[model samples]
Target: MRHFLYICLFISITINSQESIDATLIDSSNLNADQIIDIDNFETLYFIKDHTIYKNHSNKKSINYSNYQLGEITTANVFNPLKINLFYKDFNTVVILDNRLAEIFKIDFNTIQPYKNITQVSTGFDNTLWIFNIDFQQLELYDYKTNTTRFSAVPVQSDVLDLESDYNYCWLLTKNYLYQYNYFGSMISKIENTGFTEISKSNGHLILKKDNILYFKHKKKEEIQPVNLPKLLINQFLLTNETLYIYDLEKLHKYQLKIK
Candidate 1:
């Protein structure tokens, strides 16, 4: 009777663990791009090809923006599709594009007063930008309209690996830790590093990737839980709402993330 009880307990534990998270394959389509940037709530696809940023509309024509002089685009922030931010690290410049992929404003950091060696940038609140000034080792909320620094946090100790932000909060991923800051430049939370290479935020939750495995961390939870997903080559991924889009170089797989 003791052996039978142990066997039943083990099966129950296994079943519970496997049902923690469910990934239902919703769609899989062939993708032809060098890198998948993001998919908006409207299901519009944004990608890069030959160093140009392309926006694919569902029922309309596709538009793109490219600056051959900038060498290559380091990253793009499409948080506000109306105002897309493109960072060109090599040139230390950022180009703002309209929804139609038309160049609207260009910021050349080299010519700005009190030069800032900005290594990373993301969209901030109205007429503002979140920038990492390498010289001061600080994350600064820059007011582009006024050409002034609205808020600058204390210097960070480690190199910033990635920087992402919503309108009210900014998440900075460094070599040693991940830090979250509010608009007032207050450090909200500091999470220890655990080989996390990439991060994406959706509705206050963070989806982190370490190696090829993905983990989900809630804003109110301390424990970082691994998301059980079927084995696949994950080259890049984007989290929008409850959908997880993974690009495996040749194809894009869309999965609906459900918690049991």
Candidate 2:
């Protein structure tokens, strides 16, 4: 009798369903990797591993190129045109590339040693890139042409969660708090509790993630709406238009999000 009751309880729990949470098991495609990065509006998918950039496109075809090392790719700048930014450590350097993955120019930060630390970086406009420097808690503007860095006073309160940017302001997350920073790294406004795990921008709005869920916030809206995301790992998530990409150990899965 005891064994029968145990089996029944297991069956009941297995059959139980939760309506509020919708989940679908997505198959793992033959995407070889421990991760994916640089999902941007620019269309091409670029991921770094073992000193190479594995690229895929609209046709579902994929290929790899010997480009930058994973350790050297301090950050991947997907926003730039047909190029990715390479940042290397212990050298205080930045490298830019062309569409064919050719090296264009390099910014040697060793020359700009005044800054205590380069906390963050992203692709910027007019032959320049954005830099977040810990020297004086400032958001720094670095010009590739002049090979110089300028500091703008912004509130660099110790607990910055995540950062994203357009040509204008910097979007950030901190313990569920969201903030917008101008080019000078000054906070323009405080947004709602986005629960944003990571942030990116396109079409004048902020794309955010909360607990493996995607949310979209228009410029003027006070709140963000939950987006339809396919089945993904609890600890990792990635999203783009129409397709949602998921990552886990040695596997990359792709799913089409059903939008209403």
Candidate 3:
């Protein structure tokens, strides 16, 4: 009787584990991620997904890579005309890429005076770049042209997870919340988030990448729905009106969103 009970328990446990895995996979597979975000910005060298940067413009079997050697991709941004910023995990250096994807500048905090232990980055609005230095726990600005800083100020006493900027406001993501900063370092009203797993934005729309699904904020009463996808652990996401691109742990999934 004891042996029989053990066998029954083992069988039940195995079945439960398999069922859980199947449930997660089923939910992911049901998601038809058809919205393939067109990262082909004419001059775009490649699309950033799955902690790796690929030059999608290449038609040959060979492709270029911008792999993270530190640990994982910490932060990334592409600001028009041909400027890209890539920050690695636990590193004080950031790579600045120009239109040709060539290295233009490398900001190494170790060489700077008391600017070591850099943590976060924000790039947008004119030729400005915002940086968070752990040593001082303050926000600093860097000028792309002529390479100079005019001013900086701190708004919150917390670690920033993401940063988005426009002509009017700067969106700072900290932990589970998002904060807004005016151009002159004034606080704007906090935007309440419903459920966003991985968020990415452009000049047009705000993308909420949650779970195995993606949501686009449209009208006040209307929001885009979640599309199915393959089992994905998306660390980086990019979205457009017609396309949605999810970079998972091992592959890049493209979806064509149907807007009805």
Could you give the C-alpha RMSD of every candidate to the true structure, in order shown?
3.7, 9.3, 11.7
Q: Considering lDDT, where higher is better, how would the candidates rank from best to worst?
A: 1, 2, 3
Q: How do all models score by TM-score?
A: 0.91, 0.70, 0.62
Task: For residue 172, give model 1's deviation from the true position in Å.
Answer: 0.5
Residues 60-151, model 1: lDDT tens digits? 89989999999889999999988899999999999999999998888899999989889999999888899999999999999877889999
Q: How close is candidate 3 to the true structure, as a TM-score?
A: 0.62
Off by over 4 Å in 1: 1-20
**Which portions of model 2 miss their true places by more than 4 Å?**
1-28, 39-43, 58-70, 182-186, 192-195, 228-231, 234-244, 249-260
Q: lDDT by residue for model 3 over 124-193, one digit each (tens)? A: 5667677776677666666656456645665456556666665565666665455556676667546555
lDDT score of residue 115 within candidate 2: 42
**TM-score-sorted candidate list, best first:** 1, 2, 3
lDDT tens readout by residue for model 2, 45-148: 67777756666687767765553432455555656655567666545667777766667777776666454366567776667677766556555667778766
lDDT score of model 1? 0.89
- lDDT (C-alpha, whole model) for all candidates: 0.89, 0.61, 0.57
- Extract clashing residue pairs from model 1: none
